[model samples]
Target chain A: MAGTNGTIISVNKVRKSYYRDTIEIPVLNNISINVPEGEFLALMGPSGSGKTTLLNLIAGIDRPDEGEVVVGGVNIAALSESELSKWRARHVGFVFQFYNLLPVLTAYENVELPLLLTNLSKKEKHEHVEFALKLVGLSDRMYNKPGQLSGGQEQRVAIARAVVTDPTILVADEPTGDLDKVSAAEIMELLDRLNKEYKKTIVMVTHDPRAAEKAHTVRHLEKGELT
Target chain B: MKIPLKYTFRNLQSRRLTTALTILGITLVVFVFAAVLMMAHGVEKTLVATGSEENILISRKASNGEISSIIDGETVNIILAMNQVARTPAGAPFATKDVATVINLPKTDYVGITNVTVRGVSPDAFALRPMVKIVEGRAFQWGAREIIIGNSIARRILNARVGGTIKIGGDQWTIVGRFDAEGCGFDSEIWGDVLQLTDALGRSNAFSTLTLKLRSPQEFDSFKEAFESDARLQQFVPKTERQFFEEQSETMALFIRVLGIFITVIFSAGAVIGAMITMYGAVANRTVEIGTLRALGFRRRSVLSAYLIESLMIALIGGIVGVVLASFLQFFSISTINFDSFAEIEFSFALSTGIIISSLMFAVVMGFVGGFLPAFRAARLNIVSALRAS
Candidate 1:
């Protein structure tokens, strides 16, 4: 961690559940964690461990049934649905396991999607997108669509999309889960560069211990509790 | 932030067949709607164009049409003597005693028989209607058994050419000329000398109606009041020529309008359902795309508006195509029976700016109604679950 040692994300007594008809299945129970700015923290858990659910709460994609999630000083759990969306745009950037880049959009356009929310002019937005794509070493593939790129290139493009707006934090769930060993190593190297060189705050959830080993700090969740 | 319009456009383009079929459905509905409106307007235009605002028509009381009305010589003389009646610069009253009757004629295409109006008019009738211009051959002589056919009638009926003779009431009346009446109901009639026609048809002592020009259009109400109040003429009804033609067109135009609306309502239901099905399919197919958009911080309203605009664009494309197709109808003329007179009248399809605007507006309404539920469903999708869906 290179930046100021200040808390960027604070989770307190957060509880979450899922419903199957009339039955309530508990997912995350009273989870609490504090993530400092510029730290690359990895979350490792097996199946049905509530790892993705806890990541979603921290990213403002979902609200916990109990307690509060404060990211970048905003109480996201207390905000309205619309307010939560706007907060997420300015504060959190997400990378999914599926590399959720729209197939119809080119690499440049997919990275430019988050910048559309800003009041930047087209010229200015183009410059920002170019810089972000260059950071992921895919500057030459800017015009190529997601379908035309390999699995590793697609995940790199997704990373470029997440950081294009220079949000306060980046939350990625299973960023390298679908990649082969070589591609997974390359993705981890890029994530390491983002933390060490750019001082970006990243909280990633992963199933591969090799991928988690690259992070500065590793936390494990077992059966909805920290272990 | 909302997704750009190009995104929505490209999405529709991605599903070409569904988009095309939905558009075709709307096009059919709009085509039916615009064509019916044109039909009704054409009927009104043909009849209303036949009369001038400054003229008055005198007919027997309770008569529905000039063909069913009779005016005696005394009534014609009294109407001619009124001070409100205009006179020609040559000091003759601008009035004529006209005879109206229907004659059955064979269609040129051998499609069966149709009723054509035969009107007998005095010399003053030509001066009263300046729009009637002879396009071929010379005018008929005063005492000769000669007739002039209107251009439409000459074109539609067999043996109606200039210089041909047709047997009417056991007498061979020669066609002397063809005249154009500026696209009015008179364009479907044959004109001849009033005295000769009365003698041939054996209605020697009475005329069908008296048509006279008023000194000014403002004098019509006073003229009607005077004729109605006079005990000598109390058995007759006097109406402005415009009013009489309007009444003549009302029944036919209303019928066309009602029938057109009924058909349009039925077709629009099918079109709306088609649009709904297309939109619902779009939502179902693009669930992950929508979730990704929501994940990018686009509001629910933005997603809803994007889909609505897409549907509206489809409807507009269909509406434009329908209007273009309906416009070609203006080139062909159609004939139908005038309900009031029970006489055949010829008219061409007419298109107006109001009709185009209203048709497009109606298509938009259908699109909005069809796309609303599907768009709402898209907006209400749960981000977590939607992202997990393939």
Candidate 2:
């Protein structure tokens, strides 16, 4: 539930597991966390430490096996698949490790994707796409396809797509994991500016210490438990 | 909301080789399907065009074709005296006693021999069939060893041209004229003097068939009833010319249709399987893209419909191209031996609106059947695993 004190996400005793050939492998064991409004939180751990699993749960793309995930006062774990999809479209912006922009679409068209789910007019969608691309410093590269852009530029376009709908929370899974040092620093700076100036709440999973340093709060997980 | 159609089209364009190959398979199948239907329609049209509504043909009872029927001179006289028979404006009956038979003829261009219909008819034969027009030279002289070959026979048979001579039954017959019968079955026959042909062929004063024009088309029922009731005429049967020819085409047309359906079914199965393979490859290649669209708020049904639309586009394109190719076949003619008459008849392929609609509908059905399972597999993919695909 939404705590009266401005907590936007509350995960209470969530447990998740995966199954392979009739055997259950635990990924998260009775985890609990809270992210306040406008808080930039980072989850850091070794590979297979359930960091991305927790982020996915908070984003409402996956459900916890045992407990409730309440975001913006709604128990997302109890929502149906269709309702959760709509909620994610309206409230959560997602950026992936590989910058999963549709390669067939131009940068401008990719940025305009999230708005296609909304009731916005074409003019409004154009305005939103232009503003999002400009905010990510890719206004000049809007007509380029993903294959034509560098890795960092493609990620910037992905970020533009994610924030075009003005989601309440942005969840990023290793946003700079596939980038060079220069591109990584630029992405971290963009995330910092979004959190500090725009007051956008962000949950990030990163193995890099430099990327975690930009967050206001950093949590570490070890062997499926918060350490 | 459904995914945009442009996205589906762009994906097809990206896989150009697979799309083109699958479309080609569908095109070949549709072409064969349409060609079969056009062939059957052509046979029916050609045979039906040979008969007139106001004419009645008299053949011996239990005979399948005119070649096997025999009518004596006395019975021919009885039929000519009937009041139902039409007059030829000079107080003469519009009746012809014709003898029909087949002779082997060598092909002009090829070394093989084929059966050609030879008809022996009186002078009144031309009056009964107005569609037959003499295009070269004059009609054969009565009681002379002369013949007028149809234009089709003149073109294909050796030494059957106008002013040429063909040896038949130990006698030389001069070819006097060539006629066109408006693309009907009569265009494949040779006509000559009935008495001379019967005497030369040793038929012993008997004609093979009697054709007479009725006063009106509606007078056929009474004429048939009266002819059947007469004890002398009981050995013969009367049938309206149109109905007789229509019945003659049924067996051959049915054979062609059944054979066509069989071949089409087999080819369509292969084509459908090919389409399924192509669609499966598409799904496998675009797993990540489908998951991306799902994550962006598109429903599973939208994914299904998008794939279906792509498959339909391929089939429709193939269908249109196949129909266009089949339409060109109407300009060419083919010859086949009629099962009942055992004589060659020439006809062309015919295309109709009904054939086009049916062929297109069959292609669509194949597309639907081939694409459904693959689209279902795409929709059933788990979002978690799909997004994780490389």
lDDT of 1: 0.89
Q: lDDT (0-100) at residue A86 of candidate 2?
A: 87
The CAPRI class of candidate 1 is medium
Give a tens-digit lDDT track for model 1, residues B1-390.
778887788777878999999999999999989999898889888888888776788888878998999998877888889889999899888988899998888889778888888999999888777788899998888888999999889988997999898778889999999999999988999999999999999999699988899888888778878877888998898877777887888999899989998989889999999999999998998898888888878889988998888888888888888888988888878989888888889998889999899889989998998899999999999988888896
**Chain A accuracy of model 2 expressed as TM-score:** 0.98
DockQ of each: 0.60, 0.49
lDDT of 1 by residue, A1-227 (tens): 22235888888999999999989999999899988988899999898999999998888878899999888777889999998878877877888888998877789989999899888999999999999999999999999989899999999999999988888888889999899999999989998998888888999999899999989899999889888
Tens digit of lDDT per residue, candidate 2, span B22-55?
A: 9899999999999999998888888889987777
lDDT of model 2 at position A49:
97
Give TM per candidate.
0.93, 0.90
Residue pairs with clashing backbones, model 2:
none
Error of 2 at A181 (Å): 2.9
How high is the DockQ of candidate 2?
0.49
